[model samples]
Target: MNSDTRPLPQFAHAPLLLLIIAFLMMQPLSTDLYLASLPTLSSDFKVPLSTVQLTLSLFVIGFGSAQLVIGPLSDRYGRRPVLLWGLALYAVGSVLCGLAPSIELLILARFLQAVGCCSAVMIARAIVRDAYDPVHSVKVIARASTWLSLAPLLAPILGSYLQVAFGWRAAFAVHTLLSVSLLLLTFLRLPETNLHKNPGATNFAGLSHSFRLVLGSREFWAYALPGALSYGSIFAFISGASIVLIQVLHVPTAYFGYCFAIGVSGYLSGTLVCRRLLSRLGATATFRIGSAISLGAGTLFLAAVLAGFAHWSVMVAAMFLTLSAHGINFPIGQSGAVSPFPRQAGTAAGLMGALSMLVAFIVGSIVGATHNGTLYPLGLVVCALGLSIFAATRLLAPAEAAA
Candidate 1:
């Protein structure tokens, strides 16, 4: 089963591509599809907005933390079993979320759901690394990212309708059904892509060594940290958007999905551009350009809010530009992080994913705590993260060029 020695059984390219896209979509679908219900959930459970927001943070924490275990397990065992088990857990979590009568229960359910959903994300990245060479890996990841952007683009719009038509719980119900269907498909169609299995790597001693190999690499961190910060800024927006849009600027709940979609489109557009630019400019150059744009857009956003022009349209436009920068940043960062460690792809993917989600959770919690019914907090936080990305990219450039 050593991937280096044995050839993988060829599967249908289209079907496999579709499944990978589905796997990549699950995390966002779980989170974004239920977001329009945040305000409703707060009212239903008789909790404050901040308490409801804690569920989001907890989910991210669970999701990020679980990757530490899931990634290594997949590297030790195989991708298929781990993926099926993860989807099953997600299904159970979603069902519990749908049935929960208390906010506490719902928060617990969301955390479990996040933990389960993370397997899909980590495994999806691992599979790409397993199947492709380093040169083609970035292209494949960029394509997958382009498709992944659709989840954010469409999930909120669909979730909004579900919330309006049924209730906040309806999104979870739908999530449960989708997870079950994906589980069946994985069992039936998905082949074991991880031909190389490090059975000993599951032990604590081996796990620590694998982690050190990933963490000790300056190139890995140089790409991963900026990418994670860039990606986390989106979560910051997700956390603060409901209050800023619904409470402060007074956009109706039903139309909130459309507004969110506008910003997500920026990510989609950036992915498209990344796909084209990757061949010409290469990852590091493209990533640096994206970092610059994101920094500029975030600065503009903060200035707008500071200058008292905190209209919904202005915020959305600024976010759109920032997200576009994210579109370019994410795939390049992810591909770069895992590319150097071919044998330990799962561990590398897991570490990178964990750091990103952990950062997102921290930023999301900060947004929740700083909720003052204004766009100032969100703007400031995003600007700070954007600046951090710029700084990281600058620091990494010399090492990146040498590599």
Candidate 2:
């Protein structure tokens, strides 16, 4: 249990681990808990499906863009203050989202919420990099993900019930409650992990140099891009699944969460498996395995969809497989990206997060725009992402070997 030891002085490993889980889980909680409400939002707002879809794409864009600032700020000012302010903003944004009267307002609120959420996410990864060496950080991330999986696993089920009983607004209410609670917990329990704060990290000249160093690294892209592409495939499903299942395949809205849960089970399973794989195979080998799985799953999904298998079961099965791969790749990609730059871990983590969210925004928007009452758009987008993941894996192999 070696640690970098820059964390809160008196904090025990157990409590710190729980805090990490809480911080990282915010990402899934923010999105998954409200997913079941998407179609309802479309109908209630009298907007086209694509218009409603902006709530997601716009959220992703904000999430990505905010990290560019939040990461550097954390490096300059330390993670604690940045994180505290971000949580406060998230709480306010969540309340606004719940009360939004129009679809436009809801999208705006979601974007604001995303900016706040990015701070928790990027800082969590930066904390891991700060506390542990590379291999240990990967294992810690996998362990944390084991618990983090619970959010996506349960949130949709909870959300569907909320959507049915209390309407779509209930989901945002939950977000508001969770954000405030987490904010209190963070203020009380979390400590500043960025002890070696860089005074110039947020300055224009310094920020540009940090960007060039992180982006210029072959190792960062080698590890980061697969996770980003894998996440893009998952976002494709998230963006399109409700329309495909509820509208085209005709699954009942009430049962949609159960279907989603079943698919998320694959991710849970992958996280559990990731822990074992890391112990036996290490990060590089395990990452390769995950990449191959994504390629196969994506190819199969597109093939099945193109061959006219429009059943909800087919889509769910593909979701399961692709997400399983993501569960395996994400932690490793995230950790590996930041491992090289100990002094600049915050900047590196933020940049890596920005890349993934940017990919999600692009993939999600394309899925929305190309929707035509069929599974074609989802299938095409997912398969393309899978191919991209495979390419990234190949590109990263040499870099990993060199390291």
Q: Write the per-residue lDDT of candidate 1 for residues 102-151, one digit (tens) a residue.
A: 99999999999998899999998898888766777777777878889999
Each candidate's lDDT (Cα)? 0.88, 0.87
Model 1 segments more than 4 A misplaced: 1-14, 398-403
Model 2, position 175, has a per-residue lDDT of 91
Candidate 2 C-alpha lDDT tens digits along 1-403: 3352223344453367777889888888898887888889988999988898888888999999999999999999998899999999999999999999999899999999999999999999998877655657787888888889899889888988999899999988989888899899988878777778999998999999999999999888888888888888888888888788888899888888889889888888888888889888888889888988898998999999879898999988999999899899997888888999987898999999999998998898888888889988888888888888988888776553745
Any residue pairs clashing in model 1, and if so which? Answer: none
Model 1: C-alpha RMSD to truth? 3.1
TM-score of each: 0.96, 0.96
Look at candidate 1 and tell me the lDDT of residue 396. Answer: 70
Stretches off by above 4 angstroms in model 2 are 1-14, 399-403
| TM-score, model 1 to reference | 0.96
**C-alpha lDDT of candidate 1 relative to the true structure:** 0.88
Candidate 1 residue-pair clash tally: 0
